[model samples]
Target: MSDLSKRRLKLWIRLLGVTRGAENHLRDYLRREHATTLPRFDVMAALWRRRDGVTMSELSRMLLVSNGNATAVVDRLEADGLARREAEDGDRRRIRVRLTPAGLTSFEAMATGHEAEVDAIFDRLSDNDLDTMREILTRAGKAT
Candidate 1:
């Protein structure tokens, strides 16, 4: 096989394994250090980055979770007092989601801790390799 052909048929399982490893690493860190699940943190992470609170549909799209799944996650966060939902005064049907002050504090702490773990994971790469990897992955994400 030509070099390109070999890459074209490369074992997807290996790629999945690598992806799973990264997921597991983050999940483990979130569980042990933050006492939270990856899904919950992901929801908070999305909201934390938003200058203003986002609508449920926006959160669903940004997080790549189903509307139902996102709703469930939001419900859990609300129950735990980590998130608050406000109905748009003009449009009663539309709701906005934002992290509570407590939630923001929690998200910030988790972010700092998570950054360290992510940096540690990438520390093995040379600077050039890391930059290239970042560029490639960002393009890959946009393609998605």
Candidate 2:
């Protein structure tokens, strides 16, 4: 293999390692500190972004997860009174899920902690380093 090809392969592995490490850390943090799972946090985050609500299919698409997976999370949220599912007008088959007031308050608190945790995780990276990484990642994404 060419030198550049070998370097690219190494870079990919390094990226995956870093991503997984960070993910694991966040997962543990959420579970230990908030009594919540990462999937629940993700679902809340998506709902937080779209206050109006989103259909099950739309939510699934936005999260890049299967509808069943999204439904399971939503079910838990609804059971906890953190979210509600309402049928769209004249569309009995389409149920839109949204964060309840309690859910919004809960997510706000969680989001603050989540941001702080993420900031701390990346605290070692300088502004310039972040810029460079973003540029490189954007280019790599385009390449794919």
Candidate 3:
């Protein structure tokens, strides 16, 4: 293979490895410290961003997941009193979901800890390292 092609492949592998390792560490941290699954946390995070709430279809699209998957997670959230679903006034079939007050509080707590955990995980990287990586990733994203 050409040198350029070999370098490209190696870079891709390294990127994938880093992404997976970070995700796995986050999953373990959330589970052990918060007693929450990543998916559940994700659902709550999405809802917390929109105080007014979002339609089921909108939520599914935002999360890039299937309707069934979003519904299942929301169902669990609702059962736990972390989320509430309200039927549309004109169309009962359509429903909007929002986080409860308790959910907001819980997510705020989780977010604070999550940020700390992530910072600790990458604490070895210097400010210059982070800035350089961010610029490189931004360029790569724009290219795609």
Candidate 4:
């Protein structure tokens, strides 16, 4: 391969490594400090964004997970009284899931911790470094 191709390959590997490492750190942090799984946090975050709630299918699409996976998470959340399911109006078969009041409070607490954990992970990057990285990623996203 050409030098440019080799460099690009190395960049891809480095990007993937950084992404995975950060994710792993967040997962561990959430598990240890909050006694919650990352997936649960993610589901709650999505629901938090849409307080009106979302259908199971919509939640699955938002999370980019299988409907079954979304259902499983919702089931656990419902069991814990952190989430609730209500049949959609005029469509009993369509169930909408939303976070309970307790869920919202719980999520807010976890979110605060999550934000700190993420900030700590990227604390090494200066504002200029962040700007440069964002610019590069934006250009790459446009290309894709």
TM-score of each: 0.88, 0.98, 0.93, 0.96
- Stretches of candidate 4 off by over 4 Å are none
Q: Assess candidate 4 and give its TM-score to the true structure.
A: 0.96
Q: What are the root-mean-square deviations of the candidates from the true structure over C-alphas? A: 2.2, 0.7, 1.3, 0.9
Candidate ranking under lDDT, highest first, comes to: 4, 2, 3, 1
- Give the per-residue lDDT digits (tens) of candidate 3, residues 1-144: 999999989999999998899889999999999999888888898999998999989998989999999999999999999999998776878889999999999999999999998898899999999999999999989978
Q: Which candidate model has the greater lDDT, 1 or 4?
A: 4
Q: How would you encode candidate 2's per-residue C-alpha lDDT over 46-94 as one tens digit per residue?
A: 9999999999999999999999999999999999999999989968888
Q: Which ten residues in a row are the worst by lDDT in model 4?
A: 87-96
- The TM-score of candidate 3 is 0.93
Query: Of the candidates shown, which would achieve the greatest TM-score relative to the real structure?
Result: 2
Task: For model 4, state the Cα shift of residue 45 in Å.
Answer: 0.2
Candidate 2 global lDDT:
0.96
TM-score of 2: 0.98
Give per-residue CA lDDT, model 4, range 27-130, as digits (tens).
99999999999999999999999999999999999999999999999999999999999988968899899999999999999999999999999999999999
Q: Report the candidate with higher lDDT, 3 versus 4.
A: 4
lDDT per residue for candidate 1 within 1-144, as digits (tens), equals: 898777746744666887798889999999999889999999999999984899999999999889999999999999999899998787879999999989899899999999998888778899899789799778767966
Better candidate number, 1 or 2, judged by lDDT = 2
